[model samples]
Each structure stands twice: as C-alpha cells, then as structure tokens.
Target: MSSAQPEDGLPVRRVITADSFRALKFKLSGARPAAAPADPVSLPQPPAPQVLPQERPVLAVPVEPPAEPETVAHEPPAPLDVPEEEPPAELIVENAVAAMPEAAEPAEAEPPAEAARPEPAPEPVPETAPVVAPEPPRVEAQSSVPNAGTTAASSPSAGFIERRVVERPQPEDPEAGKRAHALLDIMAMPTVGSLPQERALANDTLLRLIPRMPLKSLRHLAERVCVMESPSQLLVRRLINDSRIEVSGPLLEQAMTVDDSDLIAVAASNNPAKLKLMARRRIISPALSEALIRSNHVETLLNLLRNPGAAFSIESMWRLTRIAAGHPVLQAPLVTRHDTPSPIAFQLFWQLPSELRRYVLSRFLTDSETISKILTMNAESDGAPRKHADHSLLSELEVTAPGEAGAIYAELAHVGRETGDRIAEDQGGEALTVALKAAGLTRAQFGAIADKRADAEALKAIFDTLSFNKARVLLTYWDWAARRTGPYARIAAA
Candidate 1:
C-alpha cells in the first residue's frame, strides 16, 4: 500500500496490490493457508503512522473470528491458525481495505450469464367471462339451546317449517288453588266492591277457574253473586249457563245482572228446567217471553203465564194462545194475564175449560162485541181439535205435593168427613171451595165440607159468586202457586 498527505493534513491512499487482495479473499473465506513457499516471497510494508507528543501510540489490535460456542458431544473446533502476540493476517487485510483508493477497488466478477430465462408466455385471457352472483358469506352459528338442530343462517329451504315442542299443561299448584279460593272469597264479600277494571279482571280469572271448581263451590258462588247489588255480568252469565241446576238456579231465577238478551239465549237451549227458572224472573222482556213460549215446554209456559211481571208482545201472546189451545194447564194463566191482548184471550177462550172461559169473559173481555165474536169463534172452533186435558195435574200433585195426594183424593171421596175437616184444617176456606169445585163437586157440597162458620159463609159466597169452571181455574192457579212457593218448585218445573 502507498500513502500521501493531503492539504487537509489527512493521509491519502493508493491502490491495494493483487497479493493483499488475494489475502483478503482467503481471510474472509476462513480458509487455511497453504504451506510456506520454498523461497520466501517478500512484500512491501506500510509506513508507520505519525503521533504527536500529546497523542498516545496507536496499536493495530487484530480481530479474531468469533469463537464458535462449545456444544455437547461435538469435536473441538480446529485450533485457531493465529499467534497471540502477532497481528492476524485478517487485521492487515482490513487495514489494506481501509487504505485502498475507490478507483483501485477490485471489481466483482459478473456471474456467468444465467441461462437466458425465456419470457413467461403471457397468460391467455378469455374474451368473455360469465357474470356470477357473489356467494353470501356463511356464518356458522352455534345454537345455545340444548338438543336444538343447527340451521343455516343463509337461505333456508323453501316450504320448510320449523316446529318446536309444545309445552304440556302443568298440574295446578296447591298455592295457586289457594290463591284462587282467596280471590273468590274476597270478591264474594258483601262489604267489598271492586272497580270496573278490577271486576273485569276478576271475571276473566273466574271464567278460567270455573271449569275447575266443584259443583258445590259453584252453587255457593252462584247463590252469593245472584244476590249482590252489583254483580259481574260475565260471571252471572257463566253461572246461569252451568250444566248443574244447583249451580245455575239462583243466577237464572234471581240474578239482576242477567240481561234479557242472556235469558233469550238461554231460552234457546233444550234444557226445559233452565227455561222454567228463567220464566220465574221478576221481569221478562217480550223477546224472552216469545223465546220461552217457543220452547213449547208446558211447565215453563205455565210459569211464564203466572209471572205477572213478564210482558208479552202481541205476536208473542198470539203464539202463546195457539200453544195454550193444546195445553189445558196453560189456559188459565194465559187467559187471565192482564197483558194478554183481548184478541188473543178471545182466541184462547174456546180452548180453555168452562171455568177458565168464564174467568176470561169476566176478567179479560169487557167489550160486548168482542165477547159476541169470541162466542161465535168458540162455536165455530168446536169442530176443531179440543185442547187435551192435563192428566199430569194429578201426577204433578203426586210429584209436587208428594204425600198430600191421598188426602186430596180422600177429601173428594167422603164429603163432610174426617177428610173434609183435614182439608179445611190444612188448607183454608178458599182452598176447600177450590178443591171441591175442581173435584167436580157442587156449591152445596163445598158448604157441607166447610167446618168453620166464617169459612162456610165466606166460601158459600165465593161458591155462589164463582161458577164451577171458574173454581176449577182457581184450583189450577192455587196448585201452581203452591208448587211455585214450595221446596219442590224447581223439581216440578224440571
């Protein structure tokens, strides 16, 4: 290597020689040197660096290759080819590189020309590509529900319906049952009144609970609510339609909350007993009367006729009179009803027994012209089928009066005997006269049967005043009134 001092007082460098360049390549490759040559080859040495008195002498410390780490079961690395005191050949090579001129830097040999790589054949492009809809991303959703089958989040199969298991009704809880009973009791308390909303809610709850309540509980509830000053209409309607009479009777017979529309609906049923209870309502609308009459229930019709509070339309009375033409027991009340139109009463006059006919003419018909027309119609209808006599009257007595049937018969058998006294004692003068006349006895026999002087006078006057036909009508009227006021009224009606 050669050097010069520049104007900047820095050492200038010259080209490195071939031998130094050869040594650098060998040092970098970490190759062992060949054996020394037979003749020593001398090489030019570099000039020493100058140092001032204030500067310390600079030493050219050699860089040794890094020691390969010791590894287990591995041959020890070949001993380094370096002396500890002498500078390493690699260090001299590095100094040579640092001093070399840029122009004299050895050129890297061009790599042997890579076998000419042929240009990749351009990829063929199709002239036209089919347009396809992009597929929707699939989401694999894991169902948290146990035993549930996985379903695709994308398009579901057409016509596929997903079904879940329907839960079964659970057995009623004891606590829930107790709560229901408590609610019923609370609502039933007379002193307690509910707001409309509360009452409506309570009615809905009760309707749900009704099918579960026993007949006794239902009947008791019916009794309680029927008498309430303001009862739930929904509750009243449900109870009135109950299958059991005991559960429904009070509501049908006495519940003020029961509407005429409700009664009309109930009258549509085939249940004659229900109709009878409905017949006994304090007031009945014309529509309901028509419905009851349409029932053609003989007993129900009788009760309706006996109910003075019941109003009958003209058409209803006309229909009822036609029906009464066949049911002899219906004639008395139908003809006597104040609401019975004069025309309807006149039409029914021919069908009634002699006693009821007399009662109808005396009470229902004051018009002389109407009376003459009724008599003419009666003569004309004589050729028509007569209304059947009520054989059920005695049967009804046996059923309604029970043990009293034999006494009634015995009183008719032996006049002025123990039977007559028993009759007078049990029933009053009016009753004895009715019984005698109804039994086809004369006014004289009724007098003989009368054991009390006051009864005999009053009853004789009654006997003289009322014809036999009218007495029989009174008899039927009294019988019905008794039965209505009796314990077996409902049974008889049923």
Candidate 2:
C-alpha cells in the first residue's frame, strides 16, 4: 500500500500495490511456499486459493491446507522487501488472518479442493472447490426470482416450483345435453307411435311392475302418467288406487282416465288422505259423491262439500246434512255449497253457528214465495189433480181442517204416491216434514197431521222457512233414493 495527497489538500488516501495484494492473498490462503529445506531440492507448493472479487477476502481464507504441509516442519517465510514509502505486506496479511475465525486454522492444513476432486488435480487450482462453497446459498437465493424455477426444478424438495401437467377439460358434447332432455320428453310420450299389441304388452308389463316399484319411482310415474291425455287405463287405475297418497294424489286430482268406479273404490278405502284427493276431483259424479259421503272422514266430507265440481245426489246432500249436524266443522262448507239443496241447508240450519245460520236464512228464504208459485204452476200445468186447489187458501189456513181438507192433506203426504205410502207405512217420521213442506202446506197444517210425540214446533219452524222448490226437489229425490235403499234412504228414514 502507498499514500498520496490530492491538490485540494484533503486527507491522505492509501493505494494498494499488486505485489502486496498477491502476498496478502497467499499468506491468508494457507498456501504460502514452505520454507526452503536444508537440501537443495524445493518441495511442491499447494495450489493457491482463488477468491471471487465480489466476496469479501475473510470468507475465502478458510480453505483447507494440503496434507503434505501437515507433516512438514513449519517456519515463517522471509518478509517481502517493500519500499519504505509504502505500508508493509506483513501488516496487511496479519490483520486479515486475525479477522478470520480462529476455528478455521486446523482446516487450513487440509486441502478440501484435492479431496473433492482427486482424479486429475494436475491443473493445481483450488478455485473449483471454493466456487462450489457459496453455491448452496446462491442456489437458495436464486429460488426467489420468478425464473429460478428452471434452475431449482431439478431438486425434489422444491415443491413450490414443481411444474404439473394438467389435462385441459374436454368440451361437453351438445348432443349429450339434448339426449338428457329427450329422456324427460320421452317419459311424457309413453304410448306414442306404437302397435296395439305392443301397447297392451307395455301396459300389462307396467301394471305388474308398478306395484313393486320404489315409492319415489312410483310417484314420478304417477305424476307423469296423470297429465297425459290418454294414459293407459290399467296403469292409471293402478296408480290412482295406490296405498301411498304421494303415488296416487296426482292421478286422483288430474287423471281423466280414472273411471267413477275407480274413484268409488278410492272413497271406500280407509285412507282419509286418498278420500280427500278423490273428493277434490273435477266433475265428480253423484255416485262418487255419495261414496265420498259414506267415507265418514270429516276432512274428506269438507273437501267434497267445498269442491264445486262435486255433484251430490239429493240423497248425498241429505246424508251430508246429517253429518254436518254432528260435526260443526262440516256445517259451513255444506251449507255454502251451491249444489246443496236448500232443504239440506234448512235441515243444517240449527246445527250451524250464528254467522252461518244467518247466511243460510238470507240465502234460502228471500225467494221462497216466488219459488213456491213457480213449482205449483209447473206441477199444475203438468195436469196434476191438485192444480185447481187454491194455494192462497192453503197458505192462509192457520188451523187444522177435516173431510176435504183432511183428504187434501193425505193426497199431499203421498206426493210420490206409492213411495210416499211405503214411507208413511214405514212410519215416515221426518219424511213427513219434508213431504208436507214439499206440498207447500202451512206450518199449522203440518202440526195437525205430524205425530203428537214429535217436536212439532221445531218441524214447523223448518217448514215455515223451507225453500218451496228445494223441498219439492228433495221429495222427488227421497222417493227415488228410497227405492234404491241407499245410505241416504236410511238418513231419510231417520
């Protein structure tokens, strides 16, 4: 090193010479030439350490010394004769050695470069060993850059940089979606374009298989079958009568293929859920209506009564009225039904709550006189023997009369003539109230002929307020239903 002064007169700056640098490098590297032996021959020198310019010299000094030097007697070499104007190389070398870790001194005697590559060390350079020294950290550092993937990919532990080959998802087939939709469309069109024999075979196969189908499959089939315009009759009947309402409900509600007999069979079942579904059918027949009434389920009965599509025989209405008289819940729907006879409404009147009773009276009573006149005129014009009798005289009669009046009363009691005679002989009881009211007889006239043990006042109240046309219609239905001896006949007889 040499010191020089600037013209600007700043502090002295020291400049390093090439020879001093080389001496310092050889001294710290543990490869200084061995001291001359007493013999004239010179021993081979270990390879000099090579240090990277970028790395500090302290890290490069820790290279292992050669094996031959370990056995040799040690002697400090003569110092280089530096100029008096410059700092000595020995001072720089000693300072660098002191800064190195003390633990590296034993390692200074073993040549790591020769041990790492013993095959052809004739080139005698230790640069290859130190070059690999800082490689691990360099490799680790390079991993942080984006492009380090190419270098680190060879290492198994570099999981984050691993390149995986993923197959791109194949495009979905358009026909696959179309085919899936076609499956549902095919389900709706079960019987399209088939031979009669084929259809029959298909139907028979379905009938046998449907009963054993899982509940979910059966329900799906049933829901699908019901909406088809002309679904197989056997299949429809099977599903309509399924024990599970979930399987049968859609058929009962929407299937047109279901016959009235099928519905009657459903009504006969103990399943109130099925009975309710049957009652909710559109355009229910009178027979089916009677069957539903016989079901004796309050919900079924209420559902039937509320369904405007349900057509009740006058007998069914009578039976339903008796049911409503017992179940207050059945009253409102039974009374409000448009198909329900006004006579049945009148019968159900006392059983209803105040609100319903008011509705019945207002609905059935307003047109009583006009309805009575129309009925009488229709009967008289049909050439009935009673036509010429005075309705005004009959309406005004507040007391009982005999002879001609008694004969007229007997004639009125037998309005169905032969059927009335049978009913009367069978102890007509309530039938007589209906009969007398149908004849347009007054409350007092009805009282005179009714059994003395009977509740005359209650019967009179019904007769006074009864719709005349409705009563006559009930009378006709009773006569017809009595011959059939239906459940309604028993109700009428009661």
Candidate 3:
C-alpha cells in the first residue's frame, strides 16, 4: 500500500505484486508450517499469554486476520435421476465428471443439481402438469455457391477416374436387309421370261416358292421355255430354272370330278385368265359367260371369252343362249347350239309366258319346233303358272290365270291378231279393265299402242280379265284421267 496526491482521491495498493500474491495463496490455503522437535535440547517453554496493549513492545500489532483465509469450497453437483434399468446413478455421475469439469464444479458453487436423498428427488418437471417435451428444431442446409467449403473430406482418385470408353454390341445378321430389298426388286418386275427363259428362271430362283407365277410373266416365260430369247435367257437362267412345283391339279381335277357351270362360276373368280378361249375348245360353262352379260361386271367377263387364238364350244353356246334369253341386253347377240337343253332348263322355259318362251325357244329350235316343244314341255310341267281363279274371266270362259288370260287379251288388243280362238272367249269388260290397269299403263298409252279407243272390244277384254274391284279401279282411273283431260268423260260421277 502507498499514499499519493494531486490525482483522484483513490487509495493505491500493490495488490498484484508477488508479495501480495504469496500472502493471498498462503492465506487462501490456511496451511501452517510444521515445526520440528528440539531433539536432545529441551523444547522452549510456551510463551506466557500477554495482553496485546499492556505488553505492547511490538511496533504494530496486526489485529485483523486475512479477510477470507477460509477456502471457498464448492459443493459437488447431485447425481441425475435416471432409471435403474439404465446404468447406476454413481456410474452416470462418474461419466459426467469424466466428460466435463464444469458439470462437477457447478454443484460445488451452488448446490448439487439434486441432493442424493433416498426419498425421490424433486423432478426436473413443473409441479402442476406433466410437460410435453418439444422436438429439437431442424436446420436446413442451403445450396451453396462454387467453392463451397464442405465438412466432408475431399474425394479420393484411383482407377475410377482413369477408365476408358466401352465397346457397343454387334448385329446378328448385318447383310439381311440388303438381301430382303433385292428380293423385293425382282418381285416388282412385270413378267416372267419365255419357256426356255422360264425353265432358266424356275430352275434356281428365289421365286420358286411362290405357287402362282404372274400371268404376264408366265406368258413371257412360256415363250422363253419354247423359244429361248435374249438376256431373257440369261436372267431366267439365274432365276427358277432348277425348281419343280405341282402344275396339273387344275387340268386333272377339271377332267375328273367337275362339270360345266360349277367350273365356270366358282373357278372363274380365281382363274379367269387361264380359262380364256383355246381354239376348237369345248366350253364347259357358257351360262356363266353370258351372266355378266347384263351385269356391270360384263367387261372383265368378255375379255375372258374373246381370247383371239381360241374358239368356244357347243356347250358354251347352249349356256350363252339360255342366259341371253333372260337378259334384254344380250338378246341381240344370240349364240346357237344343238345340245338340247336338259329337261329341267326346258321345264323352267315353258313355265314362263308363251311369248317369252317362244322368243327364247325360237333361238334354240325352229318356230314350229319351239311350239311343239312348248306343247310337250307344258304337258309335263305343273299345269300352268299360278292363276287367280276368282277372276272375272273364270265364269265366262275356262281361262283363270290372270297372267295367262292377260297375255291373250294383250295380243288381241295390241296386235289385233285375233287370239280369240285360243282364248277361253272374248274377255268381259271388267276383266279387260283390270288386266289393263294392273299391267301398269295409262288408258291413253294403252289406246295409242293398241291403235284404238276404249272400244267395246277393249272394254269387254278389261272386264273379262278383272275382278269387280279391279274393273272399278280401271274405270275410276279413266274417270280421273278424263276429268283431267277427257275420254272417260262418258262415265260421269253417278
């Protein structure tokens, strides 16, 4: 300690000096020096106690002891309350003491976190209600800029970063595409070669597997087979020249099991070109030839018929005539033959109206012969084409079929040929009227065609052929057309 002036009125003490520090340490520990025995010399007697002021021979009596000579000992922190299932409390205390000096020190400074009393410790919990522990807060790592300093150690480099590129896989058949395209090119050609060319083409070519050689190509190939032409020879030589496939299935089957019409209609769609005319040929199927005659398919059918070097047969003529008779378009170009149509074909023929039957039969047989054929054919058929027996003509004459009787009158009225002899009788007016109206024509048109007015003969014929209602219908039509024009003007409303 020292005294000074002229500065602020504060006392100065050399507290940090070595002497003070030594004194502090000595006082802090309060440990006295141990005295040694006097040995053989008698120990000095204890000094008599003296009153401090009365015996004041000492210059300064240091009265006050060091303010805190007592050491400030800190209490050890209490052991934590963990479950017995866990390690013992003493082990936890030992662990914490080993981990952090602070954990053990704090309890000495304050009180143990809890006293180790046998009675349960006051829980580190609120007194009133059990607490719900909150979860520790999470922290997200933000993406960083380049040169980001990572806690992760630097990556190691070995053969991993030093490897070479890998090889890719190869195809199974590399030239297959070229072969396929080449085959397509050959198939695209228009024709096969001539016969010798055909033999060459068929002998060794890729085309052998195809059962049908195209027609145009077959034509060329047939020529080559029989004649032997140019490079056509060389090309066919490289083609199917070595191969053999079945070729007789068509002709053999045609000769054995098949007949004519089936041969045409059924096989035609499949092999029309092959079936075309061959000179002096007997056509097994002519009806089919004439069928497309009136149909829109006629063009394709005709091409098959007019194969230039080939001619058709008697059977073809029979079939053509039969079909042409039915179709108005083919009627002009009649083909004649003498096969004498089968009984069934003739049966159907005579069953039709006499006029149509005569027209058709005229082509097959002479006029007189056709009439006799019809007579014979009629005798054999199911009587006559069906008739409406209750007709007006029934009571007056024997004829009952509306169609048959209609035909008779149609002739007498239109051609004025006096069909009267054959007819049951001159027809009644009602039958004639009905027959005319039902035949689908206006009275005027019928009159103009017949070259006569609705005369007594016409009236008789119409009534004779008609029912009461059919007759009245005709009369009504007359009334209507006349009112619109005239003629039936004779028959007024009453």
Local distance difference test, each candidate: 0.56, 0.58, 0.34
Query: Compared with the true structure, what per-residue lDDT tens digits does model 1 show for residues 272-374?
Result: 8898988899988888888888888899988999999998776676677667778788887877677665555544544555456546546742324554455
Candidate 1 structure, TM-score to reference:
0.39
- Per-residue lDDT of 233 in model 1: 76
Model 2, residue 182: distance off in Å is 10
> Which prediction has more favorable TM-score, 2 or 3?
2
Q: Is candidate 1 or candidate 2 better by lDDT?
A: 2
Best by TM-score, which number?
A: 2
Ranking the candidates on lDDT from highest down gives 2, 1, 3
Considering TM-score, which of the candidate structures 1 and 2 is the better prediction for this target?
2
lDDT leader:
2
Candidates' RMSD to native: 29.3, 25.9, 31.2
lDDT for 153 (candidate 1): 30
lDDT tens per residue, model 2, 1-494: 23334686433424333323443445655656545455222233434444443443333343332233321224343334445554343344444566657545312211222123223333443333222245444444234454445556567577565444432444444343333223335434545554566656556655545434566666777777777777767667767766678888998887877888878876777687788777788888899888888878998888888888888777777777777788988887887777676656655554566567546645765445776676577557556634322444444334534323444434564354455454344332444565667566666666775637456665566566666566665554444454645344566556
Indicate the residue-level lDDT of 357 in model 2. 55
